[model samples]
Every structure is written in C-alpha cells, then in structure tokens.
Target: MLIPYDQLEPDTLTSLIEDFVSRDGTDNGDDTPQETRVLRVRHALSKGQAVIFFDLESQQCQLMPKHAVPKEFFD
Candidate 1:
C-alpha cells in the first residue's frame, strides 16, 4: 500500500526516511550526512518521484522509486 508522506507525523516520517537512506548499499561511502539524505528522500516524495510502500504479508514499510512500484499497487 502507498502511505502518503504527509499523513505521517513529522518525527515518524523523519525516522522512516533516515532508515531508508541508511539502508545497506544506499550510501556506498559517499559521506553525506544523515539529515541531508533524509531531506533528499523527502524532496523525492514531494516531487512524486518516490513512494512509501507497506507490504501486507510482512507488515513492513520502505521507500521505493515511483516507477519501481508496480502499477497495480496504485490501482
């Protein structure tokens, strides 16, 4: 399911974005600060270039590029 970023609390959204940015192989030693990365993710969300996905089976959530999410998910 798609979770609108605006619907989440600011602190909860920040934590979720931080975790998404810090995931394995996400940085590749680029040395960017965590807050900076979080901002980037938020920007993507605002631009509709990225989405938050919640998996029903796993009850887990993560950020994904808009195109990376199947079209069926949106329907």
Candidate 2:
C-alpha cells in the first residue's frame, strides 16, 4: 500500500527518511551529510519521484523510487 508522506508526523517522517538514507549502500561512497540526504529524499517525496510503501505481509514500510514500484500500487 502507498502511504502518503504528508500524513506522517514531522518527526516520524524525519526518522523514516534518516533510516532509509543511512542504510548500507545508499550512500554510494559519497560523504553526504545525513541532513542533506534526508532533505534530498524529502524533496523526492514531495516531487512525486519517491514514495512510501507499506507491505502487508511483513508489516514493514519502505521508501522507494516511484518508478521502482509496481504500477498497480498507484491506483
């Protein structure tokens, strides 16, 4: 399921973005600051370039690029 970013509390959204960006391999060898990474993800979310996905089975939420998600999820 798609979770709207706007619906999340400010702190929750910040934590989520921080967690996503801090995951291994996401940094891509760049020494980008955590705050900058979080801002980039937040910008992507606001621009519709990224989305928050909630998996029913695992009950986990993930931040993914919009194009990477299945089209049906948008409906």
Candidate 3:
C-alpha cells in the first residue's frame, strides 16, 4: 500500500526520512550531511519521484522510487 507523505505528521515524516537515509549502504560513501539527504528525499516525495510503501506481510514502511514500485501497487 502507498502511504502519502502528506498524510504523515511532520515529525514522523522527518524521522522516517532520517532513518531511511541513515541506513548502512544508503549513502554509498557520499559525504552529504544527514539534513541535506533528508531534504532531498523529501523533495523526491513531493515531486512524485519517490513514494512510501507499506508492506502488509512484513508490516514495514519503506521509501522507494516510483518506478521501482510494482504497477499492481498503484492499482
């Protein structure tokens, strides 16, 4: 399921983005600051370049590129 980023509370969204960007291997050795990375992700979400996905079985939320998501999810 797709969870609209706008529906999330500001703090919750920030924490989610922070957690996503902070995960090991996410930065790929880049030296970008956490805040910058968070903002970039936020921008991607707003621009429809990325989306928030909620997995039913795992009961976990993930940030993924829009193109990477399965078309069935959009339906």
lDDT of 2: 0.96
Q: How many pairs collide in each candidate, listed in order?
A: 0, 0, 0
Q: Best by lDDT, which number?
A: 3
TM-score of each: 0.93, 0.97, 0.97
Ranking by lDDT: 3, 2, 1
- Global CA lDDT of candidate 1, please? 0.93
- Predictions: Cα RMSD each: 0.9, 0.6, 0.5
Reference-based lDDT, residue 7, model 3: 100
Clashing pairs in 1: none
Question: Which consecutive 10 residues in model 1 have the weakest lDDT in total?
Answer: 29-38
Q: Ten-residue segment with the worst summed lDDT in candidate 3?
A: 66-75
Report residue 21 deviation for candidate 3 (angstroms): 0.5
Stretches off by above 4 angstroms in model 1 are none
Give the lDDT of residue 19 in candidate 2. 94
